[model samples]
Target: MNTSQEQAEQLFAQSSSEMQADHFDTAEALLVKALNMDPRLAEAHANLAWLLDRRGSVSEAVRHYELAIELQPDNARIHLNFGATLAELKFFHAAEAAYHKALLVDPTLPGTWCNLGALLAQNGRDDEAETMLGKALALDPAHVAAHFNLACLLLRKGRFEEGWHHLEFRDWYHPAEERLRCRRWKGQSLQDRVVLVMCEAGFGDMIQFCRYVAVLRAQGAAQVDVLSHPDLKPLLQTLDGVGDVFAMDDDTSASDWDYWVPVMSLPLYSGTRLDAIPAVIPYLQAPADRLVYWRQKIDQLSPRPGLRVGLVWHGNPAFENDAQRSLPSVQTLAPLWRVPGVQFFSLQKGNGEREVKRFQATQPMTDLAPDLKGFADTAAAIEQLDLVISVDTAVAHLAAALGKPCWLLLPAFMTDWRWLEERTDSPWYPQVMRLWRQPTGNDWAPVVAQVQAALQAWAQPVKPAN
Candidate 1:
C-alpha cells in the first residue's frame, strides 16, 4: 500500500509523460487526479496551468499559477513559466515583474534573464534589454535564446553588423532544407553560377526578402531559381531575372545548382546596411491578363467609384502573436467606410470573412475575396487599386513590393523587429509607404482615427492616387 502523497507523485510523473506524448486531455486528467490526492502538489498545479495557457484558458491558468506560487513560493521555474505566459498575453509590465521575482528567487536561471530581456526589447527598452540578455549569456555562454533575442534587438535598432553576426546562432530552419546538397553561398562570387534561393519563414517574410533575387542578379549570378509556398509561385514567376519559381512539393534536383542560400541570408552575404537597403520599385508584377481582368471586375463592383482602396483587416489566426497582430474584426475598420469618395474593397478571407458579410446591409463596399484564389489574384486586384490600406500582413508587403502607395497600421507591442524602431517611414519601401503606429497598448481606435484624418486629407482633388 502506497501513501497518498507517493501516489500523487506517481500520477504527476505519468501526467508529464502523457504531455510529452501529446495526449493533452489525458495529461490534464492525470494532473487533476494528482492534485486531488495531494492538494499541495505545486508541480502538478504548475503543469496544469501551462496546459491551460496553451489552450487559451488564460483566466484559469492565472488562477492556477497564483495557487502554485502560494504552494511553492520559492519555485523559480513556476515564476518563470508564469512570466512567459504573461509575456505572450502582452501583459508586459506584469510579465516583467514576474521575471524579476524569478530572478530574485534564483538569479542563476538564464532563461529568466533571457525572457526578461526579450520582453523589455518588445516594449522598446533596448539598453536595459541588452544588459539583461548579456547577463544570461554571461551565466551560460551557450544560451541560444539569449543570443537570438539579442540579435533581434540589435537588428531592430539598425545595428546590422553585430545583428547579423549574432543571427548565425538563431535556429528555426527546417532540418531537411538546412541539409540541402548544394554548397551554401557565403557572399562568394556569383559570376556564371546557378544559385537557388530557398524560402525561409513566413509568407510575408518570403515576399519581403525575395527582393534579394534582384540583388543576386546585380551581383552577376547567371541563373537564380526560387522555392517558395505554392500560392506565391504565380506572382514570383513574374519577377524580373528569376529563372524558375517552384513549390517545395514540386520536383527539385539538387545536382543542377552551384550554390543555394536561404532567402534571408542574402542580406548578410550582400553586405546590406541601413543606408544601403535595396528599395527599387516594382520588383513583383501581376500577369498582364490577370491585371486586366481584375481592373474590369473592380470597375464593375465598385458602384460608388472614386479613389480605389484595398482593405485587409486581418491575418493568419494560427500565428502565435495573432492576438496582438490581428484585429478583432472587419467591423473594427468600419470607420474607413465613412471616408468620402473612396471606394472600399474587402480583401480579407478565411477567419474573419463573416464580418465582411455582416456589413452588407449598411455599406456599399465591394467583396473581392471570393474571386481571389491565391496571391497572384490578390496581386492583380491590388494593382487595380490606387492605394492599399492593410494591417501588418503579407498583403501589405505585396502592395509595398508592387511600388504602390501603402499605409501600414502597426500594433503597439511585439511590433516586429523588421519594422525597426519608431520612424513613420519604412526604409525598405522608401517613398511608397507610411507607418501609423498605435499610441498605446492594444488600442487601435486612435490609430484608426489618425488614418481617418489622413484619408480625409488624401481625398482632396490635389492628392488623387491615379
Candidate 2:
C-alpha cells in the first residue's frame, strides 16, 4: 500500500476505537478524513455509509454504500448493510436484490438468510419467508434472531405449538429477572405458592398478557403479584384473580415472591392455542369511583349523547412503523364526523394530541386528553362510551380488554403478529373487537370510507318488532 493508503488505514483504526466508546461524531470525522486521504478506500466508504445510516442521513448513506459496492463488488458485508439501508427506506425489491447478491457471494451467512426472511415476512410473502427463515436456523440453530423471527411468523400463521416454544429465544430477561433468585416457572404446579409476573415490552403487551394472571390463579397460585408499568398500575389493581401490582420505579425486591415469569410467557406455559385462548372479556375494570366520574363528565359534555363513540387516530411516534400504522392526519377521520346523531370523544393521548384542537373548530369532537391521567382513567372513560374506533395501539388493547365495542384500524405494512392474519375479527378480543385493515400501505381512505358507512348504519335506532 502507498503512504496515503497506510495513513488512511491508521485513521480507520482510530475511528474503530472511537466508535467502541460511542464517540460517533469523532468517528465520523475520522472516517471522512480517512476517505479524503485515500479516495479509493472501499473500507472508508463503507464505514462512512454505516455512520450516515445510523444518523438518518439516507441519501448520503446510499451514495457511499453504492460507491463502496462499486469499489469492492464481492464484499458480502457491504451488500448486507446496503440491503438493510434499502429495507429501512421501504425499497423492498432493491433490498431483496441486494440480499440475494450477498448470499450469492457467501451462501453460508445465516444472518443474511435471517434478514431476507424478515424482509420477505414484512412484505407478506409468508411461504418464502418461512423457507428462508428455516434455512437460517438449519445453518445456525442457536441463532437468537432467526429463532425469534420464525417464532413470530409461525405465531402469525396460528401455529402455536412450536411458536410458543421458539418465542422463548427472544432473550427478554431483564436485570430484575435474575434478582428474583427463584426458578423461572415452567408450567409447574403452583398450588399454595407465591408467584411474581414481570411485565415486558410495552403497555399494549401488558394489557394483552395480564389475563394470564387469572390462569395462574386457576392453577392454585396462592398470590399472583404483577410487576407492572406504573401507568397501568392502578388499573391492574382491578384485575381479577390477582394480587398487588407494583412498578419498576417502586422500591420492591425479588425476595417478596417465589417463582417469577415474564407476563407474555404465561400463554406458552398455559398451553395457549388459537382454538383456546384465555378470552375472558372485561378482565380489567375501571374503579367504581372513576366510572361514576367519567359517566357524569360525559353527560355534561354531550347533554343528549345519542350514539356515543370514542376515537384514537394516532399512536406513539417513537414506534418504528407509526407512520404506516397511524392515519395521515386528524382530518383523515373527518368523514366519521358527518355521521348523524353521533357524539365523538377523543381517546388519543400523547404524540398527536394537538391535532384534536384543529378538528374541534369544524368537526366538534370532544377532546378527552385533559382528564385522562392514567390507564385507569382511560378505562373509566371507555366504559361511558358505546364504541371505540382506534388505530392499532394500546388504546385498542385497553378497550378490547374492557369488553367495549372496539373497531381496530390496522396497517397493511408489516401488520403486527398479535392480530394474526386478517379475518376482520380478533380472537383476542372475541365478539367485542372488529378489525378494519388498510387494503395497502399508507392507504387509509378505503378503510375510513368503510368505517364511515358502518358508523352511519350503526347510529340508526333499532325498531321494535311487531
- For 250-345, candidate 2 gives per-residue lDDT tens digits of 877544677889987888999999999999898999888799899899999888749889999899888888989988888999898888989999
Evaluate candidate 2 by giving its C-alpha RMSD to the native, one decimal: 1.6
Candidate 2 — which pairs collide? none
Per-residue error for 161 in candidate 1, Å, reads 2.0
Poorest lDDT segment (10 consecutive residues) of candidate 1: 170-179
- Roughly what TM-score does model 2 have, to 2 decimal places? 0.96
Model 2: CA > 4 A from native: 464-466
For all candidates in order, the CA lDDT equals 0.88, 0.90
What global local distance difference test value does model 2 have? 0.90
Poorest 10 consecutive residues of model 2 by lDDT?
248-257
lDDT of 1 by residue, 27-75 (tens): 9999999999998899899999999998989988998999999999899
Clashes of each: 0, 0
- Report residue 419 deviation for candidate 1 (angstroms): 2.0
